[model samples]
Target: MAIRRALISVSDKTGIVEFARELAAAGVQIISTGGTHSLLEKEGIPVIGISEVTGFPEIMDGRVKTLHPAVHSGLLAVRDNEEHQRAIRELGLDYIDLVVVNLYPFAATIAKPDVTYEDAIENIDIGGPTMLRSAAKNHAFVTVVVDAADYEGVLGEIKQGGDTSLDTRKRLAAKVFRHTGAYDALIGDYLSKLGGDPLPERYTVTYEKVQDLRYGENPHQRAAFYRRPLASEGNVTTAEQLHGKELSYNNINDANAALAIVKEFSEPAVVAVKHMNPCGVGVGADIHEAYQKAYAADPTSIFGGIVAANRMIGEETAQLLSEIFLEIILAPDYTPEALDILSRKKNIRLLRTGELASAEGRKSDWVVTSVEGGMVVQESDVHSISEADLKVVTERQPTAEEMKQLLFGWKVVKHVKSNAILLAKDDRTVGVGAGQMNRVGAARIAIEQAGEQAKGAALASDAFFPMGDTVELAAKAGITAIIQPGGSIKDEESIRAANEHGIAMVFTGVRHFKH
Candidate 1:
């Protein structure tokens, strides 16, 4: 069948007029609906309204316009089948060769803080998806286009060859399915929030293909980046690269972890992450001082690690960072001099993530992990565990300085993978034990790393101690006080151990398990 009819309807009218004019020059009849029709008419292009073709007026504020059998029959009819041609001839339906559509702004509408329930419900599109599905199903005869970005490619193909190839149509059909799947997932997420369901009865996720990476965790495995289904304006997916080489899989992972930890501090702060764990973190008067202190905390572990700063990168900070072999460095902005200095290192991945602190509030959901065939999801360990939330379980209460260190350690430990332990003194990390098999083993590693520093340092655990062994180990390590989420069945035994060792202990009602 020769391409003759094209349907054009879109919310994002970015270059639609030129695209439609090109189709018209190719002798394709343009059929559009409501606002799109008016926009095309204003451009002096002849466009037939869907109501005229269907012989029915748009009812219910134009919601009932394109849902008619005539609209779908044209898109679904096969050009090569005699029976389909016969039915189209009998029903007097014109063949629709292409469909151009972008759904309503449901995600954007619901994202607004002042959006009402009724407003969000109305933004949920129905006819757009119906037409898209019909055009996608009959890809042999119809071409489907969802995003405006595809307009140029589709027009290029049609201009080069009189019609789009079968391969292009098949690829566009797959994109249409993905488009509808993502749209539905956004709706499900919205409804789930209005109601009180943490997880939908069935899980549906949508991801748009962003780019293929150099490799996965290792160079041998394949990898790619996908944006979250209904992500807000600014996220890791939307970050910009001011300069430097492309990011690897581990670089993105460690950068994300570092960014999450840096956002927790309201003041000038720096966090260094290695292997998806915070190796060094510090807050100070200036970004330069913060970087120096964070680097000094553990210079050995900071090697080849990802560093995140909450403030602009100064020349001094950049010079300090340039001295090390760093994998990635992210900050709100880099001074021109700082960029010039850092750009000298060609392989370093420098990303300007521009005030993504606002994006942190949008992520309250859990981190998900997939196994051989099943998956598990839990809430993110971002809950602010305040000192007031602690219930001094042991007879001895933490001293003023110990309580401050306990709070500092608690904040840092939340970003570590469980079973995790963090030892800190004077609001700086002395040692970290992350992703250990058991709690006691993690405690031992933390103390061993701290060495003599453990004598005055306080320890923070991500979860409740199952047994008293971890508490006993902390006592033997000379830890002055300990803070953990106390919810074990043997909570009394752990408390007894802390008291027996004369160590101050506080039980925070909240747990900060990261894994």
Candidate 2:
């Protein structure tokens, strides 16, 4: 097929003028609609108005333009079919060999701080996607273009020959559908969210590629990072990497885990994470104190771990952090001296999430995990509890200091894997046992890690103890107070064990289970 006629309509008029000029210079007739026509006329280029092609003026504010039978017949007609050509001839329709179109600025419009719902709904383009899809469906005969960056190459191919190659047309056609599909998915998601249904009957999400990682979990696997457009503030994807080498798969996962833990605290806090679990967490009067306490909590696991802080990092804290080998340091911001000192470590990833780190939460409360054939989507474990929410169910009441430590411990335990136990002292985690097979085993690991520190520490369990065995072991380790959901069938036995050991037991009535 020869490139005798081209349709040009675009919301983003980046290189359309030059592209259209080249097309016209190549003796290809240009047909455009609305703003594109005015632009081409003002640029002194000979172009046919869309009204002339459709034989009808645009109505309903140009929304009905190019949606008539003339445009569809030209795009859908099979060039080599005698019957189709006869129908075209009888209907007085000509072939549109090329289509260059892009959808409206729906994504950017919705991202604005104060955009109205009417404005966002009005920006959805109906005719543009229909035209693109029509042209793409007949890709064997029609050449479609959606991206501005492809203008030069596409024009080169057309200039070299009379028409684009079949391979190029197929590739561009695939791109057109993907572009239009993503556009429709965005609109659907926006409307579904406005409908106030968190889990609709059908859910669709689209992401843009951020970068290709060095590798996945292992050297043999390939991986790339994709982030949702318009992600909420203070997200790991939204964090700025100021210095260091590119992030690895494990680095991003560990960093995200650290961020989740740090986001739970409003005051100065630090969380050191390893293998997608928090090894140490601490909250203090200042960042330096918090960092020191976190480092002291688990010195062995702190090596080459990801550290997230909710406050600005300064020179003093940087000096302490420089003593250890950490894979990453994420904070709200960094002082000049702190950045200078940390940037020297060429392989350490430094992430700045801005002030939102102090108050930022996830965009949605949904967590999705893949299984063999499908995914299981459930609400995220964002359950929170206050001091007032804790019910003292045992004879012994926790001291004010113990209450603070238990709250801090509760925050950290939620982020740990199931069968999790965290021993906290002085608002810092003395030890954490995660992903164990049984409650007693998890308690033993936590107690052994805490060692002498477990004597007066507060133990926080992600779920109720299946039996009194965990409490018996905690009593032997001298754990003074305990926090658990207290919903187990053996809850009475566990409460009796707490009373016998003179331990303070509080029931949260809420469980935080992370697998």
Candidate 3:
């Protein structure tokens, strides 16, 4: 199985020159097309042009080259079949032993901020993918290379035995299909998006593998991380780990939850997350004050929790954070002294978020969840409310201070699991009750967590109270103000209970249920 001929065509010519030179030195005749042909000839390497094999010139802006029967038969011809051998001898078809190719930069072209439709369409490689798939389909006789990273291993195998092993060819062939599948999916996604149908009847999206994690949520399961190519700034996937051990499945999930909550505020803010739910949240004049408030929000739960901040972590803030055991600390940046102090801890993951300012508050569009047999994709919850948006549904109007706390609590409650309740005091969360079976049960848990802090705290519920029970519970805890989406059949009962307890209640006519 000695190698005699190879086809080399690529858009990403990282090691093409050296690889071609080595292949030619091994007595393998190289056939190339377009830019690849010019490059090999310029490098003083022996080569044969594609037109020389196909007996036709490149036409239609080089789109019709290498698409002739000669290239396909060379790549797909069977070496062991007598009939195929007769066709190869009588019809003068040659057998290609190897295919070195990579698709055009369709993903990169669309990623550009101002990329045009014509530019993107022109970059799609037709012949490259065709040759790759043809050779990949006949993996028993031909070897295919798609990634530049595989160059060394393929070259070593060829140098040793003059051909790739069956296992190597199969693996490379699998990679070729994945590469082409992602390429085609992206092109389809772009066309659908341009046609003003982002989530078409057949929804398709593409992601690239980031890394393999140690385990899944549990030690018994395996896991890996994949990143969406067009993900915006400040996403957990874009975080640059500065210090710590590798992130686990739970760590990435919790960090993403924390980032979602922190991204809601324009001011200096911090959010603590555990088990994909916000345990504590705070907003203040500076990062230090925000950190202090967040730590005090749920001191017991904050231990080993994921924390995300919108502002830079200063030395003072870092000093306080270093005093505790946290799984991860994420922020836009950190001071030199702050990094030095935090880096001293061996296991805490410190991530510096990149380019949050340019995100322009376009947080996300689609939210996806995985079920057993399939997945669920829906539009993300980007709802926000202001003072003007609140309806005075109770007898008492919320005071100025109570109104501020209500708004803060509302934002935090949105990120919590429903049935959710959050109690806020001043500029920080005092307690959060999430994932309960009923509204009253959730309020009781929130009140218990707040303890004495619940007396003056304002409460925000993710949904409307079914009856007066949750309102009565909040009243007993001395909650001064309440905010929720008010559209339940028993809304009057809750309003009566609030009025009886002299509590101010406002409704935004909107719900924030996170299931």
Candidate 4:
């Protein structure tokens, strides 16, 4: 299997002239099509056009070129078989020792801001993939190259001996099929999106590796981060780490959780997350007041947590944050004085992401979780309930101030792990009970945390109370009002308990389970 003839066709023409010159100097005949032939000819290299090799004119906008029997018979012929060689000799087809091809820029074309459907469809290459597949299938005798990066290495192998080794040929063949498969997947995804079907019968997504983390959630596991391309919005995956060491797996998870919760509020807000659950959330007139309220919510739980702010962080907020040992501080931007103050803590990771989008403008609406052998995908819990959406179910109606506190707590409760309960006073979370197995257990934990502060505070439950026990306990803990979905079978019993204890209760008509 000597280097008798090679075909070259590509959309990206990097380092092709030098590699082709080496091949031609070694007595290898170069066969090219269209742009590649013109490029090689201008570079003073001898080449043969594809039409000459196929003995037919390229027709139909050059879509029918290199699809004839002459090209396929040469690429698919088995060099070691005497019968195959005899058929090749009788058909007068020269042996194609190599195939160099890359598909059209379908992905980049579709990513254009104003690309049309007809333009995308026209960029799909037919003859290139066909020729690559033919050469790859007969890789035991033919060499196929899809990536320009492999051009020099391929030339090195050919110059070492008369042909590329069997092992290298097999590896290159595998690369050809992989390239074609990804190209086809991109086309399928683009077409399916045009048809208004986000989820097709078969779904395929592509991601590029961003970085390797220090480890997974634990020290014994390995992990890496990847992100989807062509994303225009800023998120945790799109955030820029301005200072400190590389982020850990748990750091990224908690940061993302904090960012999501902070994005729910329009006012200046701060959310502190621990173990992927919001331990503290506060919204105020400014970021300094927001940070102060959030830190006052649960100082112990905020020790090693991640904090995110929806507004620019100031010097006072940074100085207060420096008192705690936080893993990361994320914000839309930080003042020069604030950055100077926070820079004192060398290990604290600082992330500067752009402003958070509104609830309606958020992009991450799909949730994915993995099981043992597969994954479950569903829409995200971006549910929002307005003030008018709440229905008063008890004899006593919540005051306007209590309703505001309840809404603040409700926003924080949705980010907590279920069964969840959050107690808020003055637009800041005072206590949170998350990841409990029962409703009453979660309520007790939150009440115990609030103690004297629970008096006159509003309670927000992520889901409905299963029985009157939670209401009875909340009444004993001095909780003045409660807000829940009110869809439980024992809703009447809970309402009666609320009325007996003189506690005002409202139903949101929607649940915010976050398990």
Candidate 5:
């Protein structure tokens, strides 16, 4: 179809002037609503107001502007159908060939801390979505444009071929539907929150396509990355890739896990992650020593895992990390020599996650998981258990050194799966039993893995022990003090077992269930 009429309405007016000028030069009539019409008129572009087409002035706070039949009829009219063409001519409606519309800034508005509920509701664009969906529905006859970034390419294609291609129209139509759907999802989520529903009446998620991966978890499976609608200001996903090969699916997953753990520390720290679990984590006076201690803690597991450092990667630290076969290394900055040495590795993925720590006192959002037909969403387990939060439940209290081991084990236990138990001594994890069928099984596996190291080590459980058997087994393995989230009904029996074994026990009141 030849370009004839173009309808333009947008809250974001970037590049609109030049786009309007080019369309006018090509003999295309421009019809726009309130703000867009005024903008085009100021630039000396001949433009007809939407009110002129609809025979009604914009009413009710401009909400009733483009919802009329004339606007949609022109967009939906089938060029080759006699009945459709007859109805348009009989109703005195002009055929609209192109629609350039972008919705209001609902996401940006809601991001403000002091934004009122009424202000957010007012920014919701009803007419824009209506026009976009109508034009997209008739994409065979009308081309729809939602993003300003697509304007240049579309205009270039139209200028080269004297008309937009049918394939281009259809592809743009799909983008239009996705755009409107995302907008609706945001609105629904906000309304659901206001109504105090635990879960949204409908799932409203928006993701922007990031990249096409080489493959998924396996080579045969296809994969691509789509980021959440709003980019987290200083998150790993928004990090810059300084050098190295493109990240694989598993690399991104492990890198994210490493960042999550490293973000917990305020001091100079380094964390090595393997298979979504931390192999080693250390805090030191300098990043070099932190990386050294972390690597030495579990040299075997750090072989091909992801490494994340809270501080910048120095040349000395980079030299130590280069000795290992790591899949990815991430930090805020890298020294020139450090980047040079790390770049020598052909397949290592290096990322510069500027400021990996969350802003002061900012709470991290919940992580949501989807399974089968249901969704699970809960607050992030980023809250650290402080010494003040631990309450001694048994007759004996934990000694000073055992308290440090208890805190270290508590941090490690949060990353493990449910029915999880971790045994640690002197800030190093001795053994871990994660995702077992029962708590007793978890305790047995942890103790067996620890072997002789289980003696005098402190234990941490993600949740309360339902029975006394776990404590009995821990005592048999020579455990000293245990820390757990105590809320079970049989908690008294577990406390009695700990007292009988002269093992100090503390309840944190908070659970760190990872499943």
Candidate 6:
């Protein structure tokens, strides 16, 4: 079909002027409204106002405009159908060959720090989406353009032959639908969140693709990274890769996990992660000492793991890290000597994430997991278990030093996958068992790894003990103190086991089950 009339309306006026001018120069009539009309006319591009086409003034803050038969019938009419053509002629409605529209800045408006509900509602576009949907639905005869990025190619196709190919039109139509879907999803998500609804009647989420990874968790799997438009501060989603290769899917996931765990500490801390669980974590007087303790915790698992540091990486830490085979190293800042030493590894990815902040005391958010047919959304288990939150459940009370280790192990266990167990001593994790089928299994792994080190260490379980077996096993492995969420019906059995072995056990009453 030959192009004759085109409508242009956009809130993002990116390349609209030059695009509209090209359309006008190509002998196509241009119809525009509001800001677009003013912009095109100011640029000396001949344009017909929407009021002229609809034979009605824009009313109700321009909301009543473009909802007329003149726009929709023209866009929806099928050219080859004789009845459709006859109906348009009888109604004196001209066919709109192309529609170029972008919606209101609802997302931007809501992103403002102090935006009100009324301000956000007013920015919702009605006419723009109506025209876009109408034209895109009839893409076989009418072309639709929603993104400014497509302007050059669309204008080129029109300039060459006054017609866009069916394939191009179809692609553009798909883009229009996707754009509108994301726009509406953002609106829905923002409104639902503002209303303080934990789980709305409908869940709507929109993400912009960041990049396609070289591979997923495995080489054969394909994967991509996406981010929410309004990403919060100090998240791995906003991390900047300072050096080395593009991140693989596993690298991104592991790095994110490492970052989150490291941020849990307020002191000089370091965490090494593998397969979404921390292999080693430590807090020390300095960054170098933290790295040394963390590396010593699990040397084998630290190989090829993603490492994160809460403090700036000094030369000594950099030199030590360079000795290992790491996939990624992240820090808020790195000394010049440290960067120079680490950059020698050709394949290692270095990221500079500025000032990792603890989410403590913030409004808790949701953690979503996808099932086969649906998703499970629940409040994030960001709850922490400090010394004050613990209740001494055993007859023997924990010593001051044991209490400190117990709190440290408690924080580490929260980041581990469910059925998790962590053994800690002197503010450093000696061993961690994650994502095991049973609590006893996790306990065995952690205790065996700790071996002689477990003699005076504290053990933290992510959840309540199902039976006395784990406590018995810990006692035999020489674990002196234990911390867990105590709510299981068989809690008495575990408490009896602890008391029998003279082990100090504390219950936080708060569970941290990560999966």
RMSD of each: 2.5, 1.6, 1.4, 3.0, 3.0, 1.7
Q: Which portions of model 4 show Cα errors greater than 4 Å?
A: 1-4, 14-29, 36-47, 148-152, 155-172, 314-316, 335-344
TM-score of each: 0.92, 0.96, 0.98, 0.88, 0.89, 0.96
- Tell me the tens digit of each residue's lDDT in model 5 across 366-457: 57888998888876666886799899999999999999889878877888777899888766677778788898998898888778989999
Spell out the clash pairs found in candidate 1: none
Report RMSD for candidate 5.
3.0
- What lDDT tens digits, residue by residue, belong to model 2 across residues 1-515? 67999999999999999999999999999999999999999999999999999899999998899999999999999988999999999989999999999999999999999999999999999999999999999999999999999999999998998799999999999999999988998999899879987678877767888999999999999999878878777868989999988899989889889988898898899999999999888889999999999999999999999999999999999988988899999999999999999988878889999875343344336666779987788876666788999999999999999999898899889999999999999889998999999988889999999999999999999999999999999999999999999998999999999999999999999998889
Candidate 3: residue pairs that collide: none
Best by lDDT: 2
Ranking by lDDT: 2, 3, 6, 4, 1, 5
Off by over 4 Å in 2: 357-364
Q: Write the per-residue lDDT of candidate 3 for residues 56-125, one digit (tens) a residue.
A: 9999989999999888988888889988888888988789999999988988898899999999999988
Tell me the lDDT of model 3 at 248: 94
TM-score quality measure for candidate 3? 0.98
Residue-by-residue lDDT tens digits, candidate 4, 41-112: 999999999999889998998888999999999999888889988998898888899999988888788889
Residue 49 in candidate 3 has what lDDT? 93
Q: lDDT per model, in order? A: 0.87, 0.92, 0.91, 0.89, 0.86, 0.90
| Pairs in steric clash, model 4 | none
Global Cα lDDT for candidate 3: 0.91
lDDT of 1 by residue, 7-46 (tens): 8888878889999998998888999998999999999998
Residue 337, candidate 5: Cα error in Å is 5.0
Error in Å for residue 198 of model 6: 3.0
Model 6 residue pairs with clashes: none
